[model samples]
Target: MTPYKSKKSFKTRLVIAISIVNLAVILAITYLTYRWNAQQLQEQTIAQTQQTIEQAGTNVSTYMDELYRLTLTPYYNDEVLSQLEYSPTNSRDKLNSKRVVEGFLSSVMTLPRSEILRVYIANDDSLYSYTRTPNDMPDLATYAESSWYNEAKETTKPLFIEPHMERVYGEKPTTVFSVVRQLRSKNDNSKTIGVVKVDADYSGISKICNKINLNAGGLLLIVNSQNQVLYRSAPIPSGLEDAMADGNKIGQSGTITLNGQKYLVNVLSLSNYSINIVALHSYRTLMAPLRSNLMKSIALAIFCIMLADIGFYIIIQKFTQQLFEIVALMHHVEDGDLTVKAHVTTNDEIGYLAESFNQMTEALQNVIDRNAQLAKEIYQAQYLAKEAQYNSLCSQIRPHFLYNTLNTISLLIKCEEYDTAIRAIESFSAFLGGVMNVSKDISLQKELDICQAYLKLVQLRYQDRLQYDISVSAELYSEQIPSLTIQPLIENAIKYACEQNRGQTVIHIVSCVSQDRYSIQVSDNGPGIKPETLESLQQRISTPSHDETEPAHVGNIGLVNIAKRLRLKYGNSASLDILSSDSGTTVSISLPFTKNEVTQ
Candidate 1:
């Protein structure tokens, strides 16, 4: 009996040692599996975020390239420059020259998505022809000695002017970007006849900057080579220009904080200009999922530890019996069953076996929780994919509208109202063409032309009630702008400024270039908009206040569209500021001066 008891004690010790070893093995496996799964999740998330950012950068670069082609190429070509050269010898000749220039301006403005504000020609010390009806034609003599003219004289390359406010266009100021091309006499290649200048409305660029699709709290900023902020969304912080200038480089990615939000920023440098495209995405928001996952993993580990401690002590009695039960529980856990528990009936080896069994069950529970989480992630991904498809479909609507409008113009031309038909056809052609080339970076002059064509159509439709004036310096025409920017503003002007008035309404358009930025102002001498309306205009917040019984002027589609487009194109660089009181309503746009050239 004594020998039998001794043998039983020895066996119990052996079983207890084996049970502890088994518990350690189970813990090790659980830790390894959890860590491996976490690492995979982290890697996948980082890769997806990086791909999304990279794709956005590529899209922006492609758009800028297209803009250059549509807007700047025509200004650089010899044929267009020669025709724009100043050449009037007398007053009568000057008038004829003005008509010719006007016709040229009309043609340029009609280019789809062109941003040209105006076209002007300067002969030796004289403003010869301009889109603006010159008041006692400004002495071009002094301008000849100016930096822009000197630059044009020296390089003979198209010059891009900086942003400035126009003194001649009244207090409602706008930005201008100029392109100056040297004109050589046809008879003598060495003889410099004059200079052809194209003024592009900077407002259009602002519009483009405002239209960029950005993540919540994300910003898009446009900075010229000189590091000046050409445009910014409202409430711009000081010193932003310095930051952009300091960090300008192609494909440079980094972190920045704006308005207390941390962002992952990427910069894309324009090929032809000294302009940089800065895109921002919120870093915190991007990493939220990872943080949540990590917390869940930690909680799972704690739950596993608690279960192992409690479950092991409650199940053991005899050594041999407990050994077999613990082994069976481990097998069940490995087979993905957390419900199986060890049934041991001894205080010695059986108790240890029970502890090992509990550890296995806890580890299995963690695996089950992880699987549930993965299932949730898959469902969320599917939902996001569906949302993306919906947004893509919505974006295609504008192009469809453009096609229908073009078709209508073609039909009208066939009806034979020759003069009106030609004008309508040209306007419609330009509008549709601009829409198709929406990705290009255009010159200010081209953008202005687009606006003019759009305004002409509006004027024709509204005839007696709508009239417009535009003033732009010849010095500010060649600057690069985003394509199809200005027409929307003009459309807004016609819709909101003239639609309600039986009396004649005058819409003033002006552009100027200063040192580092440019601005465009569109104002109307009609009943000013309400304060609430002006507030909504600048913030781009649209709240429908009009019922079916309300007048059409109460809610103008063009105005809302302009605001939406501006937000998308410029991101943070472009802004729409509306000021209205007893005085007329004015919409001002500002943008940076970038000397971006179009590639062939």
Candidate 2:
């Protein structure tokens, strides 16, 4: 009952443990997939936003390129450039030069731009000038010392001046971004001729920038090479402006806080113009679509997991149900239900196991039925054998032994050898007492004493012809053996060697430890048995074999009987071994040996 409960408890815990481990694995995989997909979505969104910004930057660069080309046309005109160096000698020539310069300027002015506020050419001598606003030209010497002239003097390329209000009028005026170019003499490249400057209306710049934005609340601004903001959809935030001024090459799409709202700041460098575009996109606005998609995906994955978990639970429950049925069958078998059969549900390992168990149970029930039929006969046979063995142990010493010893005492008493007679009597008494005890086994020392007493009695009968020696080590004193086990071998030696032979018969008894076994040996120096007899006797001594027709010996037991008792007491671990040759015969008794006491 206790074992069945424990097994059921273990099965339940094992199922729970497997389920928990599987659930943990599923959760970990889901979390990793979610994180990886989210990261990929974020990277793709940022790249797409940057691509749009670059496209807008290209459009702004094209607008700047058009302005550069428009400023270059007047510088390349030879007619307008020639008048800058023409010095008129009289009134008619001066008027003729003015008429020629005015016509050329009028043609330039008629070319397509409505936003060109004015185009002017001026020199130190005031040789010629063209302007949209009358009296707009400044004094040449003082203007040459200004920042725009100094900057233009340094480069032959067209330079776009930063947007500023025209200061020629005393009051504040229209804002303009101007292109300044220094005119060179047509013949001598180094000659100081005049400077042509075109100012663009502010509305044209507003057209280029105002139409572009990255996202809602996103700031779009264009900065010159010096990092000053020239045009913007919104004012540049201070943090971004400072980063730009410091010339730090910040990476695209990083978080920045603007007016307590997070924005992703990105910059685009225009290759065709001396400007960089900074765009600040609101982070939340940019991620809104991706967030919606991610939520949908997560919800779908969770729904799938829920369905899978339900299926897994049902499968595990069915699996445990099959196991429980097998366990119930085992419990019946434990309670001695050899007729019980386990029901097979599935063709898995558990099902195969249940099938094998059912087959074993049926086979076991059949064997039990067969064994019950033979029980009485076997018991009767075993009882008769045990009774024979008991009687044999009780009378191991022959009646002739007692008769001869009593006759030896009579001879000793007549010879007045009292001490020898009394010693013989005492030895006989001890040997008789040991044989009377019902214990089938005795210690090695006790068996040895009985053997010695039997030998001593035999010695008195043939005092000169019989010679014997006993050898034993003290360590084997407590080793157990069948009572009177060794005495029969010694008596057999005396009977065969002393009674049959003419020459002196010498017997040797020795005990020793060998190979984790206690061995007692009885040997004799006498004529050996015939070869055929020795082999036949060894077969019987190897295992106790009997024919039912054969009669028992009336006086004493034989070596085959002793072998039977040895097998009974110690199974195959104890033995009686016999060997014979021309010189002698040796009989050995081997028992399972250990230092610990063994009870029989």
Model 1, CA-based lDDT? 0.58
**Residue 438 lDDT in model 1?**
49
Candidate 1 residue lDDT tens string, 1-600: 354466457545654545565556655666676567655744554454455545644664465444434334434445544544545578896666556555654665434445554565665645544344222213344777777666666655566565444533434344555667666665576776666666655556666666655554455666666565555554344445445457743357666665676656666665455566666555666556555665665555544544454455344433345565565566776776788777645667558668767776778688889999999999999767645543443353355345535554666667775787777777777765755664455667777776776677656555778888889654456666556556556655565667777789999889867887778888888778888767766554344332211222334444554444444455466666677775578877777666443211
- CA lDDT scores, all candidates in order: 0.58, 0.68
Q: Report, for all candidates in order, the number of backbone clashes.
A: 76, 0
After TM-score superposition, the amount by which residue 172's alpha carbon in candidate 1 deviates from its true location, in angstroms, is 7.4
* Candidate 2 pairs with clashing backbones: none
* lDDT (tens digit, per residue) of candidate 2 on 153-183: 6678877776554543224355556777777
TM-score of each: 0.37, 0.37
Off by over 4 Å in 1: 1-86, 125-142, 162-176, 201-218, 231-265, 268-272, 295-600
